[model samples]
Target: MLAVAATWSRLAAMEFDHVIIGGGSAGCVLAARLSEDPHVSVCLIEAGGGGDDIFIRAPALIPAMISGRPRINNYAFLTTPQPGLNGRRGFQPRGRALGGSSAINAMLYVRGHPRDYDEWADLGAEGWSWADVRPWFLQLEGNGRGGDDWHGGGGPVQISDQSAPRRISRAFVEACAEAQIPRNDDFNGPEQAGAGLFQVKQFRQGQRKGERCSAAAAYLFPALGRANLTVLTRTRAERVLIEAGRAAGVLVRRNGRRRKIAARGEVILSGGAFNSPQMLLLSGIGPEDELAAHGIAPVHVLPGVGQNLQDHLNYTILHRSRRRDVVGLNPRGLVRLGRAAGKWRKTGEGLFATPYAEAGAFVHSRPGLDRPDLQLHFVIGIEDDHMRRLHLADGYSCHVCALRPQSRGSVGLVSRNPADPPRIDPAFLSHPEDLATLMRGARIMERVLGAQALAPWRGGRLYPHDGSDAALAADIRARADSIYHPVGTCRMGRDEMAVVDPQLRVRGLQGLRVVDASVMPRVIGGNTGAPAMMIGERAAAMIAGAGGDGGAKAIP
Candidate 1:
């Protein structure tokens, strides 16, 4: 009886011209860009609270922030048991706030290799080639190093050099050079096959210094005062209210009440890979057999709604650092951090201002590969089990992950309940080639660690102390897990399994689109945040009746 009453209440409605579900990384960008035309009313819904928490703003607090209580801003999801990792369930930490995972991420501003976008174009995501999307990437960036042919100026998201990187990070880069990897200053430059320090998506000037420039901070917060834009936070969107095979509005739950907010223009799903596919499935738009099994009348039979799940599975090589100054957890390092915090509070320039994974490398597993197949994240602290285990001593770690995994999985509905979390099975390491590539990458990591530059600080190996390939492979199978890059659930392509087309419009559906990491045909070579934002920028241009020229251009 109560269910029927709630259903009736959910039917009570309001309307907007553009309703964007999920005020996340992509949603924030869409809302800001769409609301630029004041004539059009835009609504953005988020499942979490404001992104103004101090923990989220501080770059050094990312590790502590993600593990904090209330979990209002962090959807600390756990993956299903993977046969790859010896049946161990991996931890998936996705941000629930306005900025989404960008709020909780390491703030690395890696745009991935250009070949990654070229591959997307080849895979049927037309107009998304490296040349086509390069301008869009420039259009969204407000780089601190000024404008160039490859970068932009006066954009929203600020990409700045690390304010203060640890000496160990420098050593990691030098060590990579010693290991035969070239030192490339800019990973987003003409080439992406080397090692260097990473830039961050953070401000380097004015009042926003020493703070993260999340999507909420960069795009949504500034656009909040606009009358045409309505940002409803702490509200969960249940499902898209599709009427007569067309998306009409979204039914959302807030303050113990359900209301339908109609979309006159289009309903865009920006809820990411996990939530977006779940939303579509809940709306009866997934596999017909699965919907019937869950007692749902199918609205659209899209077999690939939650298919093609891909992620970068990484294994860490930990070593106790001989120097306390090189790591963050030791007593000496803690004192330095305490002093750095005071300096950051005053001048916004200190050790506390930089994300710890400051330096990394992208290398090919073999000689014939056109681009890098392996990526390395060198951290100045032990990050085993996602930092759940804290060692009292000084230590550093290197994480190696296969850039492109052939393994695929699925996200499915356990039941018809909208509040229930979806079953995420990222069948990590299902392919033999993926594990083999990771094993090869692990050997490269060992080589990097053994380089002359890192020898002074490197102590005894804390993980898999053995130096043989057989032992390393055993350790990889026991511990390899996700590095937080999950994508390709609602793949965009011309294939029959594709959920969305190249225009980001959902196939076999009208008045609907999906603009997020979920629409990625395949996972990119680097981080997903920058690419996800690029998708948002391009999606907004498409919706505004413009082609690919809607964003703030470079000032020539």
Candidate 2:
């Protein structure tokens, strides 16, 4: 373990078998798995503090950590103004600590529909079909419900049902069922089109039960006792050093001093959707024209280095609740919260253990669709503008997002300096089809909230709309933004636009690969945290030449 504030006069030059940039969700998995052989050395570098604080471990403090005002453990990056969003800039809050976004997220453990991976294989991502990748997902999960054909038990990543979901959350699920959406106990099972409580990436048993089990807590921290692994926090990678057409090392800066760390084997970038592509462009491995425009000498000309950006654009519907059980800023709610905190500390179960977005549903926006095209999240409290805005009255919110959008965007350089944030443009709702689907979804959600199952709790709709297409379309354009699932900037495929190959290796480059959500051929139907870790697990096997098809064996 190392800190940036420590003196590094004696650590001028260091070498490792593998040098991984961005100590995030996937990077933690890579560092832990690759260093298990004992003979191999791994170095993991992160630009944030260690992710073991109470703000991250406690499940209910999500709003505090996700706030942009103080920027707790979040990057809180703002996207470029989207013409599709009435020219309003969207908020993109990414985690900046060891566990990455998983540490600050709502901890929903979603695997997406199986066909999502099948689509990846269809898009020239060979050896990544549903059947081929199922083992990897099973191998990474430690489900509290025990192992079944669809889930795994005793794995590194802990998953559990919400300890004590709020009453309004249950009411929302019931309302979904009343609206004709079937009740599903497990979204990762045979069927995905239904409503139920979402399983979270949290400890299910033992002393840490109900706590957030981020990738760093599940993998990296457990492997820290290994002598061959070195974890460096608050260290930023400026660029990758390419010598003789091969990735040789990374130049990093810590505490204002720059150092060169050589990689004897490989250099992996796991900086999520935005930073991974930005790193490639900074290393002069992107388009020739973009490089020249930035005053950078192009080393590799991969035109797709930062293209194909996709995300789930979400619009939330809120209602003031007549019931006091839902979370709120009112006096009665605050008193309940104080008592719940004490109970949580004593028993690891209470209101403080809530993940907030406790219940959700997957449903098709219209008739005749084979699978669900819209996903919904039920929040226990009123949330607007990513929770940046607060409400004093007791209320609840339901978030609806199109499962797969057709719009494409890109991540580009603002300057050659690595310190500058990437220029992000999700280009949300640019396609007419996306807007159509969201309109249908919004109508469906309104019906569900109006169902008799939620009549006891429903108070007043926060954002009311006249029943008309134009009103709904205008509301969508004004309020819709990202649900924080951004992917496909450094897309993986065999096409000319693919940034990385099927094996996750950078096209036309050696000893370098991208193993994060950025390499996703398309964004999945749900959250990106679990899929990102699965990518790391599969990539480790491929890099180590272990399983022939990159299938991970269950860890005993």
Please list the C-alpha lDDT of all candidates, in the order they appear: 0.86, 0.89
Q: Cα lDDT of model 2 overall? A: 0.89
Q: How many residue pairs clash in each candidate at the backbone level? A: 0, 0
Estimate TM-scores for all models. 0.95, 0.97
Candidate 1 residue-wise lDDT, 179-231, digit = tens: 99999899998899899999999878888797899988999888877877777
Clashes by residue pair, model 1? none
Q: Candidate 1: how many backbone clashes?
A: 0
TM-score of 2: 0.97
Report the poorest 10 consecutive residues by lDDT, candidate 2: 547-556
Q: CA lDDT of 448 in candidate 1?
A: 94
